[model samples]
Target: MTNTPANEKWFQDRATEQIHLEQLQRAERFNGRAAMLGIVIGIITEGLTGAGIAHQIGLGPLIDGYTACRTQFLPFCF
Candidate 1:
């Protein structure tokens, strides 16, 4: 069987659309991974900053203050 001009154009268009869709999906996945990595780094940095602050002020007092603050404020925030 032979393909007519219209059929050839249709096939080409379909292939192009498939390739474009795949590229978009790959871009979205990469962006999602990057965002997740960024969140993880942010959490780690926050934890490190908190730890340094705790060390400077003394661990026992920091924990007591955090516990008291959380206990008082967390219920209202939630």
Candidate 2:
């Protein structure tokens, strides 16, 4: 039996492809977890800020004032 260089090259190529695929899967899972954590932190931060603002200027009045200003003010900020 003769072992050819072409056969060796084919095996090496397949091994490289598999390693790259594994690395890609690991990166995707890491990114997904990071995104979920970021979203949770963002929600908590927004809730805390809103609560602090309400406490400073009465909850009911603050909400009413925000509702009134939002229609006119949000467009410019966005």
Candidate 3:
């Protein structure tokens, strides 16, 4: 039997949804791998530098500078 218009529309919708889902899954897998790689790099750098991840990335100094600037009490800022 030939497919009805309604059946064709439904099939098209399903195909579109499947494509969208596959794209999302691929993007998620890529993001996860990138995150893992970043973590590994950070760990290696920390080991070599003898510094915590935050300090290695300058996050510690940035936060300290921000806090000092906000409080206007610390000797160093920025």
Model-by-model lDDT, in order? 0.77, 0.76, 0.90
Over 1-78, each residue of candidate 2 has an lDDT whose tens digit, in order, gives 776999899999999999999999999999999999977776776587764434444586667567767777554422
Better of 2 and 3 by TM-score: 3
lDDT of 1 by residue, 12-73 (tens): 99999999999999999999999999777767765877644344445866576677778895
TM-score of each: 0.62, 0.60, 0.74
- Give residue 50's error in model 1 in angstroms: 2.6
Instruction: Supply every candidate's count of residue pairs whose N, Cα or C atoms clash at under 3 angstroms.
Output: 0, 0, 0
Model 3: lDDT of residue 75: 68
As for TM-score, the candidate ahead, 1 or 2, is: 1
- Candidate 1, superposed: residue stretches over 4 Å from native: 51-78
Candidate 2 residue runs with Cα over 4 Å from true position = 51-78
lDDT of 3 by residue, 1-78 (tens): 999999999999999999999999999999999999999999998899888788877699777677778898776666
Order the candidate numbers by lDDT, best to worst. Answer: 3, 1, 2
Model 3 pairs in collision = none
